[model samples]
Target: MSGGVDSSVAAFLLAQQDYDLSAVFMRNWDTGDESGTDKGCEWEKDWEDVQRVCKKLDLPCQMIDLSQEYWNRVFEPSLKQWESGVTPNTDVWCNREIKFGALLERLPAPTTSNKKPWIATGHYARKSWSTTPNSPHTRPRPKLLRPSDRGKDQTYYLSSISEEGLSRALFPIGHLQKSEVRELARKHQLHTAERPDSVGICFVGEKAKFSNFLSSYIPPNPGPVVDQVSGKTLMQHAGLWTFTLGENARIPGMKERMFVSSKDQLSNTIYVVPGSDHEDLYSNTLRVSDFTWIWNDAIPPDLSTPQGFRVDLMHRYRMHSVPSTVRKAETGDLIVTADEPEKAVTPGQIAALYDGDWCLGCGVIKSTSR
Candidate 1:
């Protein structure tokens, strides 16, 4: 449950429904402070909180350490992506690989034939069923829907999960708003009622910033920071991994606020342009690889033809989707061109496409064009 209010409430809701249920705390990372001193791991505290909540709910809970799995599956690939000057969204991989893939496999089978074992999570997304008669397979398909809580919809993060994994998944609190979740926790006297939301829990804890966590793994390259327009060196930065596209370039002794325009991994240079509205930061086209479509295995024929699929592409979580036309590139990668030039079409980040409220698929952004 991660000792969080949302998860606690999710468990409670599932229990109240009288479904055969059990709790499992998946320990993914080992953040034992790189110094190797007596500083305890934050996960230990989280584990304790999970144990307490499971006890309160009168549910059997067990801990499964998946540090190696997480390292191999999520962390290593993320570091490689960062090293190549592409910002990766590690949480997407975590949710698909560990939470749904590995942990779900460990869940005990149902004792009765009538009951089905499902791995439920606290994600703010909903799933619906539909049938596609026009397609080759005319069976019912599970479609990933946007949550009723509009602002809290997390379908973008979960776009990469397979249809099979999603079929066995359940999101108990997707229909409720964040306030309602907190209220439910408070009403039940759960310990996490007042606990604040944990941001970026996949890579780092509440105390450790992402830059600090990344710095521990990737040593500073100390490269030059250049201007995008003039190609003139502005300053020196610790490393290319330290910053992301569209983030402010906080160069010491600089007078004006500037935004990151691009980074050259070969030259070890960061290019910056003044102001958030800089034209260099926006891209008209982006290439995406490692595509996963939940609805259909093959790309829609229209996308391959001259008449491309008009889709809304979401590159980052919670950000509004951009109206775009998606087509298959000659190299087999998916090419998406925004209707209007969009800002920070980051490489290695997931490009989640949608048609109206239904999410079509997701892919890793490979490159962008200005």
Candidate 2:
């Protein structure tokens, strides 16, 4: 439940059903492993909250530690991507690798009428099953759909999990808005009724503390911060990860506000433009590789063809999907071209596809160009 109101309401809503339900809280972060202190991530308190919710619902609950899985599958990969001068959405990978992959695999086999053990989370995403299967012999396939609350929909972060993995999942409060969830929690007198939403990645803590935390793990590689228009070096940067595209350069004593237009890892330099709306900050095409379809066999029929597949693509969470065409190369990589230019489509970020409200899947963006 992450000691949050959303999960508390999810457990509450599911408790009204006849099916068996037991809360399993996964602890994916261990502060002991990091610099040896519990500052930001408080898994113990979250476990306590989960237990309280389960107790109120008259259900059993247990805590499972998945820190090792997170470190290997999510953190390590994110570190590598960050070191390469791109920030990967670790939350997206955490869902695929830890919550759905390792933790789901560790669940005990169903001993009851249900053939496979099902997992329900507080994720803000919806799912549906189709009678038509990918192949005649296979059962109905699960489609990841957008939640009713578009503003709160989390289908983007959920696009990487396999179809089979998605089939065994449930989202109890996917239809409700954030306000409705808070109201429901309050009506039930849940302890977490007023708990504020958790911000950023749990282990990473607040945004202000992020660079400091990352510095502990990554050695500084000094680089030049240059103005894009003038091609003049303004100052030296400790690391490229310290700044993100389109954000204020935050350089002291600059008369006009400057924003990062791009970063060149090869040149070891950060290019800044004078303003946020500069054309240099946007791109019309993104290069992707290792594209993973949720239903691996269900690649769009025309994706590998010259015409490519028509799909709406989202490169960042919470951003509206953009009209795009995705084509598969002979080398098995993907090239996505957006109908309109997009701002800050960075490398190592996931580019998820959608056919209307249904999520197809995602892949890492290798690069972006005009």
Candidate 3:
């Protein structure tokens, strides 16, 4: 449940629907200090809370050990990205690997007599069902879309999941807003109703410093910072990994607020500009690799046509989608041309393609061109 109101209410709603449900708490982190205290992890309290809720509902609960897997799959890869001077979203990988991937691995296989059990979470995203005739299965593929409550839509984070993954997924709280979710939790007498939402990594708990967490894995390598305007070395920084695109990095002799425009890890140098609006920090075109399609078929016919196709593209979570034209580059990479210049289109971030609310697929942004 991640010790949150939305997930608790989701479990309650699933019970109300008479669906057979099991609450699995994933233990993803073991190193203490997650509670912002030296006394080891307080996730035990969270687990206790979840157990109480399960008891109230008379539903069985189990703890799945995914700590090692989470570290190997999500954290390690993210550290590599940070080492290469790219800001990676650990939450995105956590959802893909731990929440969805690990849970699917642990679900008991269904018997031939009944349909396979589906995995449900409290994500606030609309699941689209196909209505076309002659569809292959009795159940259509579930599409990921923005929740009716746009303010809390989480479809952006789930943009990289494969179509097969979405088919077996359930977002029980997709239709409810935050206020409604809290009300349902209260109505059901869920203890988590009044619990503060968990921030950052679930196992890591709230108040955990990102720098502290990162420092454990990536050693600080202080390097020189260069001024873009003066073309001169300004000062040194703790490490390139500590900064990100659009970040105002503090230096020894900077008179004005400076923004990070680029990083050259090979030379251990970071390029800084005066404002957030430096031309080099913007791009009209981006190339993406390792494309993953959410739909079952190949690239949609319209997208593959000679004329190509245009759609809305999103580079990061919570950001508004920008209109873009998609075409296949000579190397088979998806080339996206934004109608207007986009700022901070960072490499290693997924560029999700969409047609209105339906997610087409996503790929890792490789590079950008002015």
Task: Indicate which candidate wins on lDDT.
Answer: 2
Model 2: worst 10 consecutive residues (lDDT sum)? 131-140
Please, what are the lDDT tens digits per residue for candidate 1 over residues 302-354?
88888798999899888888899999989989999998998887888999999
Total clashing pairs for each candidate: 0, 0, 0
Ranking by lDDT: 2, 1, 3
Model 1 quality (TM-score) = 0.94
What is candidate 3's lDDT per residue for 1-370, written digit by digit as tens? 7667887888899888867678988888765423455354666777888898889988888888788888899988888988888777677677778777877787776654466668888888878787334244565666688887877878878887767678888898988898999998888899899887667666444533766667777888988888978988888877778777777776656678788888888988999898778887898898988878776454666565666788899898778889889988779888889999988888888888888988877888888888
CA lDDT of every candidate: 0.84, 0.87, 0.80
User: Lowest summed-lDDT stretch of 10 residues in model 1?
Assistant: 30-39
Residue-level error in angstroms, candidate 2, position 300: 0.9
Top-TM-score structure, candidate number = 2
Arranged by TM-score with the best first, the candidates are 2, 1, 3
C-alpha lDDT (0 to 100) for residue 138 of candidate 2: 68
RMSD of candidates 1 onward, in order: 2.0, 1.7, 3.0
lDDT of 2 at 259: 91
- Residue pairs with backbone atoms closer than 3 Å in model 1 (clashes): none
Comparing candidate 2 with candidate 3, which one achieves the higher TM-score? 2
User: Model 3: residues >4 Å from true position, as ranges?
Assistant: 32-39, 110-114, 131-139, 203-208
* Model 2: per-residue Cα lDDT over 2-111, one tens digit each: 67898888888888888778888898988887559766547878888888888888988888889899999999888877877898989889889988899888888767
